[model samples]
Target: MSFFFAALCRTLSPRKEEDVAEDYLSRDAELKVKSQTALHNSHDSVKLIKFADDTTLIGLISNNDESAYRREVDRLVSWCSGNNLELNAQKTVEMIVDFRKSTVPPPPPSVMDSPITSVESFRFLGTTITQDLKWEPTISSLIKKAQQRMYFLRQLRKAKLPAQMLVQFYTAIIESILTSSITVWFAGATVRDKQRLQRIVRSAEEVIGRSLPSLQDLVDSAFYGRANSLTCAGGKSPAEVANTACSHADALNVFRHRCNGKKTCELNSPVFEQDPCSDTFKYMETSYSCVPATHRVVCEHSMAYLNCAAGKVIKVLGADFGRRDHTTCAFRRQKSEVEKIDCTNDAPFVAEKCDGKNTCELRASQAVVGDSCSNTSLYLEYAYICTDA
Candidate 1:
């Protein structure tokens, strides 16, 4: 019976595999057909690029005509409806990259009867691009993201993880985020911006308990070394050399291959659908040069009471909710005794409760953030950064 069952399974496996392949092919063909039809239905002047479900439509207008842009948006909305794909209005934004000086203001474009919000800076494919083509926003975002990952690095260090393994984790988690689209944007970055990025690397080096070369130094060495047929002479291993080679080649090749001649192009990170480098450690970075957009920055100091002001949202960047030697935002039970709650992981909860509101009052209590520890007194401690809604 066991022999007969084994033989039966073998006989059925090929047919099942063929059926699965046929199903996948049919679904792929159907998706392609729908996507093509959507593109075909769009205005002739509008350019569309579809990757999976993400679609971007680009339209060129002279002297702010905007008629062609609106028509394309309306057509796209209709197409999506026909194909059962609902257009997400909240995610839809319009950015006009106009370099030419004009006496009159440009007309605003609308989609699906709603006015599309115009943004000075918007994130596309992990890179923050501004209309005026400055790298400051991207750099700021990168630093902010890297700082969060540094928390994990600190945790690992405290746990006394192996140095080699910590380095691997840093490269995989922290470094990857910092360099996601470096190739696209690194050239346009200002000196100060580069210095700011290097500072983060320096912090990483400190965390790993080893000194590594600055990002600029690495880039320069990679570029110069590749230009000259020279091997990087050091105690460096083959893996290090290969990593540097891939990083060097990636930036130059991406710029030369993708953005060299194009007047206007969408430079997406993860440049190719497939891995371009054979080494598992190597990945693509992307950024673009564009015109600067108009924005305002407001700075304020928050002491015991924190307010987000009007038309702004509060984002808690980092927080340490515990008792300290100093008296800051103290929660007192008796005159001598103080109560505190460590609610580090309750960031999301606080955000959910307080974000989008004009003001919020926080009470450090078990009810608010649950009792993390008993007997030892504690207080709520946090730091927040606010941004315009």
Candidate 2:
């Protein structure tokens, strides 16, 4: 049996706006120091995650045993007490996920002798997460918000706003709401949910009297590495710049070769074989996404081989040399050892060494990527894509 547990822990209230403005940098430094100072002792089955003012403790209970989970909670309370930070138990909550066919409910978790509330869902860092991990509620909230703002779009159209102005308004207001966390939920959205979201775009297009880009088009361009726009405009005046839109034929090829499947890239300056328009100031504008990738996991002390077709080369998306979850390489390991779920060290050098190769071998060892979690059997996990050589 397994139990997914999450606890929301709060600390002291933030300073006033005026106080923050008086010494913003100092205030930020103080917060950073405070975060570093109030450290949570290492635990086997629990991980502490902090974002600005919120602290969340997440644990995976194996074999229906919650000893480590409960210990971590008590440790958090003790740490906060030692730090003189008030942990508002009234506002703290616990959410559990258990999917056994027949099982007794676990006792509710408490903080400071107060019974922490159990919720079906809670908004964490702007994302509404339910016990079942469904996206319906979050999507519904986004749709409602977008629809309410659609009223303002209609009012603008009635006022005889220009089509360009209407499109900009839709992009800034309604579209932003619809796509607030598109990457997180779009892939998991139901067919009906996707159609509902697309309907918002269609309504905006109708109001603007021109065909607006569809939600799919945006997702493909932004998340699937398809370039929606690439141009080089040059001339002396605004009209000249608007009229001149010439780009080298090999621009697309250059971009793809350098950044097709990488997570992040930097092109200090565009290097073209020959500038299409060299007479005037010609600046480049490009928008593309990193393509999707397949990932593999290699247990500690093992070796991994990544390969692609003869004509393709490896393009690393991301690589980490530690455990992020309790289950990945947890075979025969102690519960405490497997519970170090937050241990992760990014290995970007893996990309530097493996990218552009047709086949690559990786050694998952502390010698290659220094140990990120002591006493824990870490593993190598990486995601990559195969691109034309």
TM-score (all chains, Cα) for each model: 0.46, 0.57
Alpha-carbon error at 34 in model 1, in Å?
Answer: 6.2
Error of 2 at 375 (Å): 37
How well does candidate 2 score on lDDT at residue 25?
Answer: 65
Candidate 2 per-residue lDDT over residues 160-229, each given as its tens digit: 9999999999999998888877777776677899999999999988888999877766664411121222
Across residues 1-389, which tens digit of lDDT does each residue of candidate 1 receive?
00000000001134444655687787774322233253552455566655555566667665546567667667777677555455656567766666665534454555556666766766666677677778798888888988999999999999999988888888888787777777677767888988899898989999999876666544433121222113543665555445444334345454444333234333444544344344424433334433222111111112234467678776543332343332434344453434442212232444556666666656555455565455545555444555687
Candidate 2, after superposition: displacement of residue 360 in Å? 25
Top candidate by TM-score:
2
lDDT (Cα, 0-100) at 170 in candidate 1: 82
**Please, what is the whole-model Cα lDDT of each candidate in the order they appear?**
0.55, 0.73
lDDT of 2: 0.73
Clashes of each: 14, 1
Mark the regions of model 2 whose C-alpha exceeds 4 Å error after superposition. 1-5, 13-41, 222-389
